[model samples]
Target: MIQIKDLHKSYHMGANSLHVLKGINFDVKEGELVSIMGSSGSGKSTLLNILGMLDEADEGSYTLDNVPIKNLNEKIAANYRNKFLGFIFQSFNLINYKSALDNVALPLYYQGVNRKERVEKAMHYLDKVGLAPWSHHLPNELSGGQKQRVAIARALASDPKVLLADEPTGALDTKTSHEVMELIQGINDDGKTILIVTHEHDIAKMTKRIVNLKDGVIIDDNFVQQVRATQYV
Candidate 1:
């Protein structure tokens, strides 16, 4: 359901042009769970940002389910992103002032969903993450795992098509990280296309296939054989 062709992106760090991604090409079909593994400065995050439409590539074409993303204007891009993509971060980007419920409802608000319906939908996702009781709790009051669950709830607020995760388990303890991975895997089971970028071997093993990136290019793309699953984060 996703395609990339001759993708190239670079950054200007003063005079030198630091190439991040060069002629990268890949495809992800519906219901496929893909993981990206790379060391630091490998451009996995940059690739994720471009895939999410939060960052523009200097050149190349990106198509998501038949829609060409590179040609869209900011407004159109934002709309498409809001409607189709969900993001999870290592930092658990939850608003401190807002309750878990309110934070999850924020995306729907931007989508012009009515407050009542959005709250209902938000709670539905929160419930899925086993955070229904913590809905009224603030971020500081929750544990790291709970906070991540809240963030995932917010990401699923609009039932997005692609879940783009950047080191999703980075901040949690072992037990908590595993819990979060279970939740993410469950979402993938429900038919959402998932693309995760992880530095951890355990996290990479959870996906059906892993794509290794180095020097902003795909070095190896294949399925791991029966990865030893670890319980907890």
Candidate 2:
């Protein structure tokens, strides 16, 4: 469902240029759950940003669902991003004042879904994430795991083709992280194409495949027997 070849990215600071991704190549098929694993400065975030269309690569090709993702105008890029991708960040990026239901409904609002359908869909997702009871609570009113569940519901409300999660379990305690991963695994089992960018070995192991990155390149990519997060949760 997603493909990249010879991807390269760099950033310039003053006279020096820092190359973040060098010759990266990979593909993710539908119904696969993959994790991109790397340490600090390993270019994982750069790769995720490119995949999410939040940033452009300096070189190489990216095709999402067969659509070329290069040199597109901002308007078209945003449209494609909305239509094909859902993003979950390390930081729960919910608005402090918005209730969980409203936050989940926000994306549908942009997609021009009417109020009735938006609320119904938002509630559906919130219930899917086991947060229907907390729908009226604001972010600050929820615990970290609860907030992340709200974020997950928000991401899923649109039913995008692929789910991109960057350090999805990074901010939670071990138990909470395991609980979140269990939820993520359940989502993947239901056939969502999920890609997780994380440094934690245990977290990476939860995925069906692990692609290790080092110094801006993929060092290893292989599928392994999946480890159920419920074991730890």
| Number of the top TM-score candidate | 2
Clashing residue pairs, candidate 1? Answer: 174-232, 174-233, 175-233, 177-233, 178-232, 178-233
Which candidate has the top score in lDDT? 2
Local distance difference test values of all predictions, in order = 0.89, 0.94
TM-score of 1: 0.95
Pairs of residues clashing in candidate 2: none
Model 2: runs farther than 4 Å from truth?
none
lDDT of 2: 0.94
Candidate 1: worst-modelled 10 consecutive residues by lDDT: 224-233
- Please identify model 1 stretches exceeding 4 Å from their true place: 226-233
> Compared with the true structure, what per-residue lDDT tens digits does model 1 show for residues 1-233?
89999899999988899999988999999988889999998889999989999888888899998988876789998999998999899999999999999999999999999999998999999999999999999999999999999999999998888889989899988778788888888888889899999998888887888999999999998976534334443
The clash count of every prediction, one per candidate, is 6, 0
Candidate 1, overall lDDT? 0.89
